[model samples]
Target: MYQAKIMALLFVAGDQGIKEKDLADLLEIDRAALRQNVEQLKIKLINDEESGIMLSQYNSTYKLITKSEYSELLTKYFKTGLGTKLSQAALEVLSIVAYRQPITRIEVDEIRGVQSSGSINTLLARKLIKENGKKDVIGHPNLYVVTDEFFDYFGIKNIEELPKIEKFEDYKEE
Candidate 1:
């Protein structure tokens, strides 16, 4: 049953998925235990056809997503705007990625002057931003970019259609 709770959280995470290490940190359990939990959860879901959602594993990340057979219903929800709102930090990270895509997290943090891991995770979970790939730099950090969902959410036709920064510069108090 505890694994069920974990599955529920993963379901809420959407397509971005959560890393195995993050899941272990969240559940306060060791790596071996986390692996066992995930395996058990996978078996349970496999046995339940009416569950409508399935677990997906990729690059040591696990995501709980709806089964393709249910795409029609999910599409309807998307059309009806069922997505959650993002925090200010998420918006800022999204803007940085939108303008400077394929950027590493460190680069985004450098621009914002703060640790943006939380915001990046939130944006990824919301399907607004995605992992573009790893940078060639040291530690091979992941690069991020906006998804088509980003445009749909913002009502923009393309990335270039985003508002110009000069519009905000004109609002400076000085």
Candidate 2:
């Protein structure tokens, strides 16, 4: 039962994955209980011969990922452009990153007034933005900046080519 809920949360978390602490808090269970449930879920997925997905852990975050056996099929799907396109939220995040290069995820969230981890992950996966380095702040959060791919995607040679915010204000109705 708890394993099912954990799977649902991981699925909703997308590629960003979820931290163990956050997961435990959401499930209203202690860390040990969460770990036990996650371990069971991992075993269940691993033992299911027909299951194409598995739980993967990186550092303290956990994500549901397709097993390597399906790598070829997944590659073909992405090559054919069948992969999901960016959502509105992702575009908004991209815009923020484009204008504010070397900004942290927390800063982006503050500018947008919402959590942007999913969108940030999407942009990172798409190669539109990348972690330039870690900020010197307390947590040393990653600082993201537009990549060369972003230039190609936007058809702009440089960041300065992006339209000025004042230009948009000029078009606003009085």
Candidate 3:
């Protein structure tokens, strides 16, 4: 059952990816049954939601990963203090991209109310922002998505895990 499969998954994971044939042979089950079991395990992991584990398939190889959502737990966190190394303009551009991604340089300029070519270029070169491909409508300006490295550098796993920033209203009220 699921319990047996789960145990097998954990044991087999140490070798990197578990081949379906290997699991079937070890468990004395047919490929179809093994497939069903693995699918069921994937569903179980995903549905648990609370657990930070994920069943990711690298091409055809399968393994249980840390979801990459709790990356901060596995790596160093980003610092926002002095001597930390991000330039003011870099921070500004990063902010824009992080908050307004799938957005282009034109839109970013509009929001920041200034030119941002240099800053955007720097971000791209640094791999903080990436080319997420063309927009759907009109000119199809390229979109951008933050990278896993970004999470690694910032010590945050997922975007939602970013530290809650004070609202503009809160700052205005102060």
Candidate 4:
């Protein structure tokens, strides 16, 4: 039960990842106990091949990621009638990422004036956006960008096909 809770927390952490110390602090557990639980969770994720998700460790941070083998199926599922749709918040976050790609979550939050963690998670799960890499800033925050799936969904050959921001100026009231 405790391990499952820890795993849930990690899953919510998403591509930004969570540091070991931060996880320990969040769980109110000692470092040794946290390590043991993380190891157990890793083994459990590895054994649950049907889950399509896995635990990943990068520079002492842990994140939940989709397995490579499931990529084709995921794409097909999205392409087909999966009946999935993005919420308004998700669309807002996607637009920000599409326009200001390689941007950090903090920057997105600053722009939106609210925490967008859940919406970002949704975008990632739908493969509309992905973590390009960590920014070279303090804490090395993850940089996000639109994925190929994003282009496919929007019927665009490239980001260049997206409408320019200046085009919206006509809609602005005097």
Candidate 5:
């Protein structure tokens, strides 16, 4: 009962996603009840082999997103031109997120010495990066981190597998 309603609300909420609090309020249920329903829904979706969509939780927000297995088909159907390759700026942002995970957008911008919102959005659309949590600060900005897709894309088992970064002085013209 609640599961179906929650799914409908998530579908309608779309990419913006809905916070657990909001879902609870809308469903007129307590947090415990909502959690139980959400958990059951997650299990059902995961076990449903025919289901292309799954429940994705990011920073307390829940969203209905297509499973990674359908990425190729979705890319072809949407023809978004994302299949070619990532742009240079996007790659840079990805690298920054990969190395400094749980970093905020403002921090990334400061490191890059420019605004990185666009690049961050591109990486997010590609599912290579995702919002991990809110930074403990004034504005509570979202912290970014590389997703599992990132690991698979790079063909590495873990972040430790990435090559070590050498100091700039190592390659200085002498």
Candidate 6:
């Protein structure tokens, strides 16, 4: 019972996600017991229709994410005092990343017509984008891609569901 609360705390506090071992370590328990606690908590969140919270597993981490029904309330409750809004420049850089992900930072800078290192930092900090891996370029700059959190932000299941960006007639020409 108490373990569940601790598990929830670890899950919520960690931005990326929480692994089973971390939960176990928090409670100083064995794997089987920790797994059972997490499983039960997962069910409770799913079944509690009024809570508007759900457990998501990503990259081997579990996180407690708010459902759409409670987006506004949850956001308000968890809103960090830190200037929590994304800036216009960051938005432009995120759009470029979403459309051209698995792309290098230099490519993103080129599309935005500016260095964009600062904007990229902000986006990465916000979890809108993440390092996919290193590119094959000369310096092998890290590649970036929109994260699953981005889809959660937009309420979409996948990037393919993003509204299609239209190609201008002039730009479509050979």
Best by lDDT: 2
lDDT, residue 174, candidate 3: 29
Better of 1 and 4 by TM-score: 1
Task: For model 2, give the 10-residue run with minimal summed lDDT.
Answer: 165-174
lDDT per residue for candidate 2 within 66-125, as digits (tens), equals: 999999999999999878577888999999999888899999999999889989988989
Clashes per candidate, residues 3 or more apart or on different chains? 0, 0, 2, 0, 0, 0
User: Per-residue lDDT for 1-174 in model 1, tens only?
Assistant: 659767877875655578899888988889899888888888878778878877879889898867788899888887786657676778999999999998999999999997788789888878899998899978999989999999999998898899887888769685
TM-scores, all models, native as reference = 0.54, 0.75, 0.47, 0.53, 0.52, 0.50
Is candidate 1 or 5 superior in lDDT? 5
Alpha-carbon local distance difference test for all models: 0.85, 0.92, 0.71, 0.87, 0.88, 0.76
lDDT digits (tens) for residues 36-115 of candidate 4: 88888888888996777877888888888888898898889878878487777889999999999989999999999977
The TM-score of predicted model 3 comes to: 0.47
Question: Candidate 4 local accuracy as lDDT?
Answer: 0.87
- Assess the local accuracy of residue 146 in candidate 1 as a C-alpha lDDT between 0 and 100: 94
Residue lDDT tens for model 3, 1-174: 754665457545532456667667777888788778778877887888797876666665566776676787555544333424776777887877786677888888888896776677767866888989888878888787677767777888788886556554366632
TM-score: model 2 vs. ground truth: 0.75
Task: Give the distance in Å from residue 122's predicted Cα in candidate 2 to where it truly belongs.
Answer: 3.8
Clashing pairs in 6: none
lDDT (Cα, 0-100) at 83 in candidate 6: 57
In model 3, the runs with Cα more than 4 Å from the true position are 1-84
